[model samples]
Target chain A: MKLLKEKVMAEGIVLGEQVLKVDSFLNHQMDPMLMKEVGSEFVRRFAGEGITKVLTIESSGIAPAIMTALELGVPMIFARKNKSLTLKEDIYVESVYSFTKRETNEITVSKKFLNADDRVLIIDDFLANGEAAFGLARIVEQVGASVVGIGIVIEKSFQPGSKLLKEAGYRVDSLVRIASLENGTVTFVEGE
Target chain B: MKLLKEKVMAEGIVLGEQVLKVDSFLNHQMDPMLMKEVGSEFVRRFAGEGITKVLTIESSGIAPAIMTALELGVPMIFARKNKSLTLKEDIYVESVYSFTKRETNEITVSKKFLNADDRVLIIDDFLANGEAAFGLARIVEQVGASVVGIGIVIEKSFQPGSKLLKEAGYRVDSLVRIASLENGTVTFVEGE
Candidate 1:
């Protein structure tokens, strides 16, 4: 978590009061080394839980989800954004409202992947609005599966998503919680 | 490679004539252990190729790309399908036609992630028409980088993508190359 916070402070760019572009390493172009640390940290936090699968959204979350799955020795299922032709399975569906993009999109997962037997760990790159994480959790529930824990690499405490998840009675563990990002400096929350 | 082949024969569902969905292990729901074999196999195939980066398209390809990058000890950059706010810096954009979807979509990657000095290894989940693979290759070429090799988990030999890639002079290696899927049985090419 310290390594992530340090990398974020050193390289993260704040475009506006809301936008934090970390394409250099976090999302667009991934850093496998940092992701390994992220995986270890997530495992350290949620290793006690019996996680059967790692669920994540497509695009950004796939990188960290794969790392976590590798570390946890479990399978990772990435929900596709669009109704792509390659995947024809309509196993489960959930509607998520993205506060960052200011758009709502339907995220889907094949039912063949997750079921009631699965104890899932929802992983995401960032937890701001928490819509993506919620969407993944929704899919898990649809399959009658239990969400053991939600592992987030970075959580923007300024938003209400984290509180929303916690209010839902789910154990949400974030590596680095952004207390504030004023004056181009990041303040990380020290405790859960 | 035997493990991959066996997994494919066991789980791979051939849809109609050309579609082979391996999402059970390779793409949608990723089998992390099998992906390790894939990454290691790729490393052995292109060990001394001086691959500085591993490139692929988003969604399904990210898992394998991460595996290869971890094995190669390099960075991994994934091309985005649509315009997104998260992507920053200069980008190498290309128009890709999805044969399955019967539509065209533009893929973009931040230019800062890849450059002329990079020796890129293109990795993907499936190769039917090879459009996505070629799209990544084009991005590498536009930045004056060299593509060391192109790795495909499953290659449909009936499709013309592999032919096109071979004609274009790329060292294309597929773990399981299907000669045909007649009557629902997959025939893998020998000495592939």
Candidate 2:
């Protein structure tokens, strides 16, 4: 977490006190070495929770989720943002609104991948309004699986997402948390 | 490669003569164990190519590209389909036509990720008409980076993608090459 915090402070771009763009390292252009460490940290935090699968939404979440799944020796299931031609029609779908893009898109996971017997860990790149995380959690609930925990790479603590998940009684862990992004600078949550 | 071939034969769904869906393992619901093997195989194939970076498009390609980047100890960059607000406007963009989706999406990679000195190894989940791969190659070329090779998980050899890459003198490697998908059954190329 310290390494991630340092990386964020060094490479993260704060835009207008709301968006923390980590495209240089965490999201768009990824540093797999750092990601592998992040995956290891997630495994360290949630390995004993009987996680049979790692679940994340597509695109950004796939990398860290894949790395975590690799570390945990479990399969990973990513909810698709848009229904692809190859994805089966019979899927557990949930609608998620992106505050950034200001559009609602349905996230889906195949019913074939998740089941009642599985215990899942939800992972994602960023946690802002928590719409994506809750949408993924809904899909897990629909499949009758248990969500062991949620792993996040970057959490905008100034926002409501992580707090919302905690209030829902879900254990959420973020590698790098931004406490405040006031005046074009980022402040990390002290001692977290 | 044998493991990948077996996975495709067992879990891959042949939607029609043209479409083979391996989302159950390779893309959507991923088997990280098998994918780790796939990554190792890619490293085995392209390890000596001096690849400074692993390049792929967003969504499906991120997993394998992540694994390969981990194996190679290099960074991976994914081209974004939608221009993210976080992404810089000065980007290397290319228009890619998806035969399956029947639409053109412009993929952009941040100008910060690639440079003239970089040697990129392009990786993707599927190679059909080679539009995505070519589009990625164009981005690499735009940055003045050399594309060392292109590694594909599944190649629909019946399509023109692989042939197009080969004709262009790009080193093309596919784990499983479908000779034909006739009668709704996959027929792999005889030896490789």
Candidate 3:
């Protein structure tokens, strides 16, 4: 977590009061070595939870989720953002709003992947509005699966996502939590 | 490779004449152990290639690419399928047509991650039309980076992707090459 916070402080760019871009290492162009550490740390945090599957959204979340799945020795299922011809009609669907894209899109997972027996662990690159994690939990619930925990690489603690998910009865853990991003400077939450 | 082929044979669903969905292990829901084997196999095949970076498209390609990057001790960068607020104005962009989705999407990568000195190895889940590889190669070329080779999980040799890439003078390797998918029976190319 210290390594992540250090890398974030060194490379993270704040465009506005809301936008934090860590694409140089975290999301678009990934540092797999750092990601491996992040995965191991998540495993340590959520160990003994009987996590049967790791769930995430497509694109950005796939890398960290895959790494965590590797460490946990479980399959990682990412909900696809678009409806493709290859995807079957029988699927659990949820709509999520993206503040960056300023649009709402449907994300889905095939019913074959999730079921009542699955103890799902949700992972994502960032948790701000908490919509993506909530949407993933909704899909898991549709299959009668239990969400064991949620792991995030970075969390904007100033945002309401953490509180919202915690109030919804989900245990959420973030490696680096930004306390504030005022005037293009990032402030980390102490003791995170 | 045997493990991958066995997974494909057991869990792969043949939808039509050309569609083989191995979402159970290879894509949608990924078996991390098998993917670890895949990453090691790719490292064995491309050993001593001096690959500075592993490149791929988003969603499905990120998992294997991340694993491969982990094995190779290099960073992995996935091209975003759409423009986002986090991305900068300076980028390498290319248009790729998805046969399954029946649409062309613009993929972009930040100019900061790739450079002329970088030797990139492209990785992907499926190589059918080879459009994604070609598109990724175009982005690398835009940044003046050399594409050392291309690694694919499953190649539909029945299609023109492999042949086209080979003819284009890019070294392309697939773990499993399917010769035919006649009547829902998947046939592998002998000795591949």
lDDT of each: 0.86, 0.91, 0.91
Clashes of each: 2, 0, 0
Q: Which has the better lDDT: candidate 1, or candidate 2?
A: 2
Model 3, C-alpha of B147: deviation from truth (Å): 0.9
In the range A1-192, model 3's lDDT, one tens digit per residue, is 999988998999998888899988888999989988998999999999999999999888888888899999889998998877888598899999988789898998999889899999999999999999999999999999999999999999999999999999999999999999998999989876
Docking band of candidate 3: high
Clashing pairs in 3: none
Off by over 4 Å in 2: none
- Candidates, DockQ: 0.75, 0.84, 0.87
lDDT agreement of model 3 with the native: 0.91
TM-score of chain A of 1: 0.95
lDDT score, candidate 2: 0.91
Fnat for model 2 comes to: 0.85
lDDT, model 3, position B144 = 87
The CAPRI quality class of candidate 1 comes to: medium
What range of 10 consecutive residues in model 3 chain A has the weakest lDDT sum? A81-90
User: Please, what are the lDDT tens digits per residue for candidate 1 over residues A1-192?
Assistant: 778878888888876666677877877788888987888888888877888899999878888888889889999889977666767566687899888777888898988888799999999999998899888888898888999989998899888889999999889998888887777666677663
Q: How far is candidate 2 from the true structure (C-alpha RMSD, Å)?
A: 1.0
**Among all candidates shown, the one with the greatest DockQ:** 3
Q: Residue B140's C-alpha lDDT in candidate 1?
A: 89
TM-score per candidate: 0.96, 0.98, 0.98
Q: How well does candidate 2 match the true structure in TM-score terms? A: 0.98
